[model samples]
Target: MASAPQAQGLPLFYNDLQPLSSDLHANYKIRRAETAPFLAKQHAVPLTVEEFPLVQRYLPIVFSMGDEPVPLGLMGLNEGINVFFDADGKFRENEPFYIPAYIRRYPYMLARLRPDAEELSLCFDPTSDSIGDFEEGEALFEDGKPSELVQQVLKFNEDFEIAGQKTNAFMKELKELGLLMDGEVSIQPDGAAQPYIYRGFQMIDENKLNEMRGDQLRKIVQNGMLPLIYAHLFSLNLMREIFGRQMQQGAVAQQEQPAA
Candidate 1:
């Protein structure tokens, strides 16, 4: 998953915001997100439907463990175990984890100007250290107008919102087609007596997907959903990899713990 725009609640570190004004934000700037403590979770993060292919290579594409079934890119096999990120809540130097667009678009998001307003306004998380006056990074405004960097962020947010809408529509199709089902994965550690059983998530049921009639299948194919489904299927194989990494991480942690 290359995004998390549809999470049930607000993303981590984004408490609330005040409107970004040229007058009020003349000196605000944001550093590169790569090293920022932007994400603290090792759990699966939201992913737009379109991002499945890109992230499927190294991450498992699964739905949220909750009833509301949203697509997620698994950074770890279980909660509190994002193997890709290091202890400092940062991606390992040169590790090349595919950073989600959700994380990249931090501190800035589109929101309604008012409760009943039909229009959206660009807003910023004023509390973010990534924002605020900084002489070293790209500025939000210049000469009381939005700077080029601000314009770029606005465009990215706009496109992300559009993609989010498409993702919602895709999810609706999945629900209507009865393609979603409970997820499970079983793994046996070497020399272990029992296999670890994993569940509590939603996934595409291959059986049901294959049972669709010719017309229904054709409809989805024409809608360009077949590849996305295949990407998901292929990505599921990475679940075992995530589990193995978790085990490795466990061992590393144990070794690093100081003696009592």
Candidate 2:
């Protein structure tokens, strides 16, 4: 099976992929995450296009830099800092954050059987603590067949895969239309002397949209791309909110630290 899409310090703890089979994994149980401490260090998390509306209300969404530009929800602006997660990787301040399905589909990923093969197999990261050796959690298999829980995970993965395809296609169309361009954002916090300048990203060029031919605009609208583009633009405001959250949290952390 194709390995988890590799990136530097990304897709955390998903190493040593093993294709799910009844023989080897029948006894395997996954420990339900009581806390999301794993997410504490993450700033950006992969997001599906379908999640734009829900996520926009909570966090700014951006495109990851690469040939395949995956949609990413900006959990924090700086590296190794996620404002959404607390010290224990749980939600901060007991506030409700829209958990992206991508994060929810942790440990298990639908990987391709072969490079050229269209078929996909359910795979899990054996290294994850979520995958358990204990008999208390839900079983991966029962009667030598995938259990109900396994089927649910599989369905979730399948839906994720389908959404991924749609996002890819949308990105491809954006590229073809030359609508996406290099993006940057600058944020100046209340007490910071220097503004934080973020670069090396992609965003829809509104100027280009303004210059677009009427027919082209209609075509994009027909493709159901307009709302998504607007959603992204509208969500940019939340970046400042995220920065405020970060500063507030940073202060709290510093206050809690024992002085040298």
Candidate 3:
């Protein structure tokens, strides 16, 4: 989803967006994805704050770098690497991995039709193999109306949009409080001359949080922002685990190279 852009300025995993209309796509059928090959090489997946508790157990929750930083769940530490998913984007055997909702909502999203559009329309990627005029799969429409599956998909997307709002609010608070700082993680393997240092991300500054005045700290804690921040901090411990996974999967080479 992160590599090889198909459409200019499009969201991850989307090549082209078309409104889901019964008139236009009445014959379309939605095929569930058995393997999301697009995600095979993606190292980071966007995450909503609502998923912090569950996702922290599987992926390191860190904020992305740049002006508009968003939460990202690290499937691997470096670019073009994923530990839990195979090359075909299927979960590894016997491994209980938590799939982010962002990945699950791929090929379908709510987008504004025009620059000044007030409401978002339900849209799907035309290039995706998951939805189209297929002989098999669930029907998207029934008798010129949206089917049950369509209803469910819309509901899920709506919930995702709400979660995105909450995540944005959480990020705004963090930024306003100056609690985020450039993130770095270093891993030193046995007998290695130099440690592999991973950088180019943002993270919560614990010192800043600890040094905050009582009123400021109480505000975040009362607003339920503290737990998500702690969840992100706790999840940082998984960086070592992910590095070890990359080693086991042969994703990291023996030669010392900086990870960006």
TM-score winner among the candidates? Answer: 3
CA-lDDT, candidates in order: 0.77, 0.78, 0.88
Between candidates 2 and 3, name the one with more favorable lDDT.
Answer: 3
Better of 1 and 2 by lDDT: 2
lDDT of 1 by residue, 192-234 (tens): 6567777767789999998999998998999988899889999
Q: Looking at model 2, which ten-residue stretch has the lowest summed lDDT?
A: 1-10
**List of clashing residue pairs for candidate 2:** 36-89, 37-89
Which has the higher lDDT value, candidate number 1 or candidate number 3?
3
Could you estimate the TM-score for every candidate?
Answer: 0.89, 0.88, 0.94
Model 3 off-target regions past 4 Å?
Answer: 1-8, 253-260
Instruction: Predict model 2's lDDT versus the native.
Output: 0.78
| Runs in model 2 lying further than 4 Å from the true structure | 1-13, 191-194, 251-260
**Model 3 lDDT, full chain set:** 0.88
Clashes of 2: 2
- lDDT tens digits, residues 175-260, model 2? 88888777788876667555767766677899998999999999989989899988888898898888788787772122223466
